[model samples]
Target: MPEILIAALSPVGHFGPLLNVARGLVDRGERVTVLSGAAHEREIRSVGATPATLPPQGDLDLDLLEPDSGREEISGIKRLNFDIVRLFVAPMPHQAKALAELLTQKRFDAILADYGFFGVLPFVLGERSARPPVLLFSTTPLMISSRDTAPAGLGLPPSTSTFGRLRNRALTLLSQKVLLRPAHKAANCQLHRFNSPELPTFLLDVGVLADRLIVPTVPEFDYPRSDLPANTRYVGMVHPSPTMRFRPPVWWQKLDGDRPVVHVTQGTVDNSDPRRLLQPTIEALADENVMVVATTGGPHVSELGFPIPHNAYVADYLPHDLLLPKVDVMVTNGGYGGVQRALSTGVPLVVAGNTEDKPEVAARVAWSGAGIDLRTGDPTAKAIRAAVREVLGDGRYLRRARELEAAYAQRDGVAEIAALIDEVIGERAVAP
Candidate 1:
């Protein structure tokens, strides 16, 4: 059997999508080994992939990275910069060492990595002959620096006009030199430790150096980049495990009523505070004709610390695959996977989030004309009410979402990804 290696960071956002990829590769009869956090060993094995735990230095609690002393004083962008360096860039040496050790144990046909897994950087940046083909898949928005848009985290949309392009260039330069220079410098320092060459572009754009850069989203949802690298491939969203069974909430029958169903979530990671998005959404639609379905992601409904409205139902989580098909509008904190999953089911959105890659995901929701972007992490009840009303009242959002749904249905992304892996392995076999 041809063996394949997969590497991912410990975070759910980074590991979840790659887990699906491992499942697909396993289904295709590839002997898959997954290198990720120790917590995910069972989940990896459940997908039929052997699990290899990341080194202690590489497996970190990202939530603990937040500064407890003066967290309120740090700006969002500054916190984001700190996270990129600490969670992603700083662990490069340990990640690379673990991957290198795995390769030494046995020869693998190919390696599929989460784009944020900087451990693969040393080998990819070194010699092509030294390691097997490495393919990096973007789990979030494509962060590759481009002339058509501002730097990734800024959530700036694409602009082709002269002034817009000029603005993009200026911001790109500022981000590369000032805003993100620390991350770039840290990446180079790690590369030096590995005796690998310094990256040619911004560290986030390093996907260009991989043998193949896989973007699982459709082009309709991402900002257009004329200069996108030829190595980049869009294989659409990797579908979740086929065996995932959904047990609906007791109030699930409420969805069959005449009232429009609105689903709201803060996703799993940023759900520590109900006030962020969920509280406001519940308050916003309490009096409306809509049936509100709120998911706590992980926390219990009692943690909401408030009275549940008569029109609303709460659950720890209702799988998107089951819930989205019944939803007319989704209110979210803009996690990429949730947004794409919602769109895939022809559901429109009301997005309000600024943390992590959320702003970028929210911007895409609005730009694609599939929903409204409130552009705030903590939206007011008034704003939530208005956005929900507007989305429900408008036909355009649903139309666009349906268009994307049709597009999503046209391709089996997981199968395509497996084929792409075969292509890479075949090419490698033929190389002189």
Candidate 2:
């Protein structure tokens, strides 16, 4: 049995699936330890694995999972760039030092890193010959840019024409300069501690650095990419954290009612203000002939502090597995896990988000015809209602979403991941 160390980005979206994967590793007879933020120590332990903390950037790891006490103040692509630098790149030196020390102190046979764990760069890329093999997996869509696809962060759709290709190239360069240059500079400064050189870019460059990259969505659902490297394999969905238990609301039976059921959420991180997605959605569809189910991520139902629509129900955290199948349309902030869950269940979406990787996710949803993209972080009730109506009235959206559901039903991806890990370990043991 191999001793495996898994480094996860300190957010529920990233740690949630990685924790489940850690449990899978344990089930396969590997000794597993999860390295992440202190907030996730309990979750890692709940999966019957050991927990090791990542270096804290502050009293808490300031990733996307942090509450948006004042997120509304930040806007524009430049602001998004600054946020990434603030949360991820600025803390790289500490994270890299902590991770490097942990690796040297432990005798792990293999390493699994979340794509967001940029701190692993030093151990994997620095002039260290004693490091274990690395396998990278993304809980979200692949953020890397390829010849066949547009650059990430631009929220652009696919293009096969000469003009479209030219446009993609322009966006790629512009994004690198506008949204990533500062972070890249900060990252290179951190890299100097490990004696590594600066990188020209971050998005597409990271893909080239990882020989093996796993994307947790089917190929058809993602924008078509013809030049994916052999090791860039497409695995099935990363189901939500199985350890987080969910209790259905008493009015769950409303899902079976004659009215169309809509599930509205801001996901775990940006859900600080329910008004962002949930409240507006509930208000938009309230007077209409539909049932509204909203989740506050962890806030009590009463924290919403608004007049409850007679046809609406709210909860702190509802299982996507339990809620998606019964849902007619999902209105969300385009968190990777939440969108994938709804799509896999054949539920079309109405996505409105504009931060981090959200615009990218929303673009894909629109491109696939699985949803309507309002293309804003804060969407008005009128816009939400119009988008919902557009999706419900058009059968094509639901049809395409059902196609993805069939693909998602074919596999769950844990077996494929385990097999890949085995092959990596086997080949390593036999090498001279």
Candidate 3:
């Protein structure tokens, strides 16, 4: 069996899916080493991969990035810029150094990097002959610049008309040249330090240059890119984190009772403020006939810092594998993996997230006919209730969700990804 190196960021959304892939590779008898933050050490070992923590600069605590108590968190383009610079660009040199040191210590057959792990970029941009094959995977929205759609953060839907294409082109230029120029320059500064070539295109588009760009969802869920690179492959959602051990909560059986179940989550990384999505969702369904199940993502139930309503059930965490099957509708901040998981279970959604890649995820859900997008990071209770009612009352949403469920059933993401890895390694071995 081949030895593989998996480089992932610490956030659950990014690390979880790649962890599934690592488990699959390990089960098949490959030796896997995962480089990430100290927070994930136990889980990395639980999945049978050796854990290597990033250096001090790269081992980031995502929660600390949040605003202090009573202070409001930034949102929209400003937040996006903050993330690109602080979370992505700022950590590049440290990540690159960690990977370089690891390579000096051992010769692995291949490397797997999550989309946000820009540390692998030095190798990706350097002479291909100097490094092992690097396979890049995305756990979020496909951010590659496309003529069929506007820039990723803007949340504009795909357009095929001449005017729409022109609009996409115009916005793409403005984003790359004006809005995101600083990120581009910051990335190149690190590249200069590493003596690697500067990125030839926009930073997000650099994934297409990898040995293989693995997108963890079916083509139907993502916007079609007529100019999509050949190396980009739509392997089905690598799902069901096998390591997630679920013990039903005390009120879990309520899902079996008469009322329909609606699940609301702000996802794990951005749930510092319940007021953003979960709190409003709880208030939204307080009087509805449906039962509302809200998760604070990871905070204690008391950390919600508010009174739970009669119609609501709050938990600090619940495994989606067990909980989603009973959910009739999901209200979320549109984390990409969670949205795909819901669609796979044939559950429709009400998405109200605007931060990060969430707006794009919400747009895809609406475009796929599987959900309603409230179009705000902080949605009003009225907006939440209305969207939930629309998703629940409409038969088209369920039908479309079921269609996607069947599509998900036809493919196995881990198997496909493992096969791609083997193929990349085989080709590398034969290269002159």
Best by TM-score: 1
Q: Candidate 1: minimum summed lDDT over ten consecutive residues — where?
A: 63-72
> Would you estimate the TM-scores of all the predictions?
0.97, 0.92, 0.96
Between candidates 1 and 2, the lDDT winner: 1
Model 3 CA deviation exceeding 4 Å by range = 60-64, 68-78, 242-245
The sequence of per-residue lDDT tens digits that candidate 3 reaches over residues 1-432 is: 798999998878888888899999999999999999888899999989999889768754464466662124765455666768788888889999999999999889999998888989989988899999999998787899888999988888999899999999999999999888878888898889988899997897988889999988988898998999889998899986643566788888989998999999998877888999998889888889989999888899987787788889998888888889999999999998889989999999999887778999999999999999888889999999998898888999999999999999898999999999999999999999
- The C-alpha RMSD in Å for every predicted model, in order, reads 1.4, 2.5, 2.0
Q: Cα lDDT of model 3 overall?
A: 0.89
In candidate 1, which residue ranges exceed 4 Å CA deviation? 67-73, 243-245
Two-way TM-score contest, 1 vs 2, winner: 1
Per-residue CA lDDT of model 1 for 263-373, tens digit only, reads 999998989899998998999899999999999999999889988899999999887787788899999999999999999999999999988899999999999999999
The segments of candidate 2 whose C-alpha lies over 4 angstroms from its true place after superposition are 58-60, 63-74, 200-204, 241-247
Evaluate all candidate structures by whole-model CA lDDT and list the values in order: 0.88, 0.80, 0.89
* Model 2 lDDT, residue 248, Cα: 62
Clash pairs of candidate 3? none
Give me candidate 2's TM-score against the actual structure: 0.92
True-structure lDDT of candidate 2: 0.80
